[model samples]
Target: MQSFEIDKSDLLRIKNALEDNDAELQRVLLQYHTSEIAILFEKLQPDERERIINVLPTGEASEVIAEMDEEHHPAELLVNLTPEKRSEIVEELDYDDATDLLSQLDESDQQQILRDIDQEDASNIRALLNYDEDTAGGLMNTDLIKVNGKLNKNEALEEIIRQSEEMEEFYTLYAVNDDDILLGILSIKDIIKAKKEVTVLELVNKEFVYVKVDLDQEEVAKLISQYNLTSIPVVNDDMKLLGRITVDDIIDVMEEENTEDILKISGVSEDEELSGGWRNAVKSRLPWLVINLGTAFLAASVIRSYEDTAAKLPIISAYMIIIAGMGGNAATQALAVTVRRISLSDLTDRQAYITVVKEFLVGMTNGATNGVIVAAVANWYDSNPMLGLVMFLAMTGNLIIAGLTGATIPLILKRVGIDPAVASSIIITTFTDCIGFLLPLWLATKLLL
Candidate 1:
């Protein structure tokens, strides 16, 4: 399908339709997909969004709300919806999506909404809500096609057809025992090719990969990507089938995880929303800035200790900033790579050591190349070979330090059970800054004095 891009004209048309109570509103919206409508909701006022939701069919409305980013306050919109309408929408949503929306509300709101939906659906949603949102259980949907392992080809096909009536789409069939323990998986192709006499257990792929419900969502995502699966079964400790996590859910998890890592690396709290207010912005960011300020003071003290060196040769001031900035930039690059690697998978001791060593070599190569250029510039600018030599040595040494710290700090933090992305950048910045300033000045004092 082609991607839809909403424009100013489209917004104006929608607003006009809303104001005039035009019947054209539904027709205009019908042109867009559910996801596209979700995007449009982000641009509309809450009341306008409510009007739009009320106009759409119940199923489509649920999909639009499910597609919406949490920053848009979908839970609040659900609360504003009339009880009967809210129940209709909730019932239409998949248990996973319904759980996510309801979990964002207060306990009372959740209970009230739960009371209105079908008992079975509400029970499924309640079971999902008990899981941590970052786990496999939270990402899985109870909706799936499963057959008893003893069922023959014809019986399995009949079961599938019966089970599939409530589902919009399915990619795989799970084979389970009478006790609901997962036996294996069967593809539609396998079932179609099987002889009438074959049982589901005989046709099932016993080696299929599956994840425990308590597994971290990141690990679940990795397994899905590694195996190139459209969906994977989720089970409990006893291998009892619970639900299946589809590729669509894994895609969302990957996006959320990568966004969270980027935010944490930038010293911003992951909880801070892009659409949040100024007060929330300050509340989320001020603590990190204060910590950074403390680190800056440490660098300043290093500079203070070399007061005489900088005073005697004021030219060192300009060159020092260049050295420090280069070191900080290089460290940041190394830190980004290391943190991303850690996120993708756990590293063994040997692998982690090799990573650090590889980064060290990279730092040396980059440092030597930049050092030569900077040294040439310094020599030409000041007409002093001694000053140039000092610049070369300081630049090379500081970058080496930058590389070592960048790669090593994250690994150490991760070992200590800390999130490498959260603490690595701040710590690496301090190291780069302090060493960046100390290196050039100390070298210049001894060599160029």
Candidate 2:
């Protein structure tokens, strides 16, 4: 399919079609893919979105809703739909998409909507809702092709044909026992190339990677990425096949996880929507800002204790800001790298130790390089070798402190079960700032005072 972007002119045409109650609106919308329509919904008001959804066929509407970003509030859009239309759209959606939308609603709303859909679909959705939204079970769809492993190749093919009637597409077929215990997997090629009498069990690739139902979605993404899999089976504790998670779902999970990490690193809550109102923005961000302010005072207290030294040498105060700012920036660089590594996988004790040591050496080298430049500037300005020495010592010491705290704190937080991304920046900032201020002032007192 060709790529398409909804430019301003396209938006204007779409809006005009909606405004005029034009029958051509469907035609205009049909030109865009369902994903594009979903993007367009983000630009529309609630009522406008409702109108467009109402105008489309139920299956298309369902696809558009499924394609929407969660921040667009797809659940609210479903609620705004008329009950009969809502049920139709819900029924048209895949089990995973329908469950995700309903999970965002209140229990009463979810139940009411579930009652109106197919009993089997509702049951599958309820089963999925029981898992945390960030787990493999929640990410999987119950709609997939599976065949009895005891079946001969021809019988398995017939069974696949029967089961595939309900599914839109499938890349791999799961092999299960009579009790639904997952045995292995079969590619289409494996099935087609085998003799008619060959059993599915004989053809199945038994050594396949799979995830438990409760496995974290991030880990699921990692496994899928590591193995370059198109899909992975989800199983219960007893290895009973529950559902399968497709590559598309993993792609979404990866995007969500990456966005969350980026936001947390910047000290913003992941819940803050990019297009959210100021009130919501404040609600999401104010707490972190308050916490940062509290930490800022700790750095202030360090400066306060050295008031005499700073007062005696006013030039020391100016250099102090430079050192602290540089330290904070350098520490942030280390913290970002460390947090990214931790997120990708749990490091062994040896790996973690090596990581800290690596940052320490990096800090030392960078600190010395920057120190010489600052020391030279200080000597040139004050014509005092002692002041330059103090500056050099302060810069090098604080940077070393920066690297250590930045690398070590995240690993410690991870070990203690804290989200290193959320807490690391705050703690590292406090360390770098306090040490940045204290190092220069104390050195100045000893060497220059």
In terms of TM-score, which candidate is strongest? 1
Worst 10 residues of 1 by lDDT: 16-25
Pairs that collide in candidate 1 are: none
Q: How far is candidate 1 from the true structure (C-alpha RMSD, Å)?
A: 1.0
List the candidate 1 regions with Cα displacement exceeding 4 Å.
none
- Structural similarity to truth (TM-score) of each candidate: 0.98, 0.97
How well does model 1 score by local distance difference test? 0.93
In the range 1-449, model 2's lDDT, one tens digit per residue, is: 66766689978989999976546888888888899999888788899999999999898999999999999999999998999999999888889999899999999999999898889888988988998999998899999999999999889989989998878889889999999999999898999999999999999899999999999999999999999999999999999999999999999999999999999999999989988999999999999999999999999999899889878899998999999999999999999999999999999999999999999999998899899989999899889888888888889988988999999999999999999999999999999999999999888888787
Write candidate 1's Cα lDDT for 1-449 as tens digits.
67778789878878888886536788888888899889888789999999998888899999999999998899999999999999999999999999999989999999999998899999999999999988999999999999999999999999999999999999999999988999999898998899999999999889999999999999999999999999999999999999999999999999999999999999999999989999999999999999999999999999999999999999999999999999999999999999999999899999999999988998899998999988999899899888889889888988998999999999999999999999998999999999999999999999888
Clashing pairs in 2: none
**Cα deviation of 328, candidate 2, in Å:** 0.5
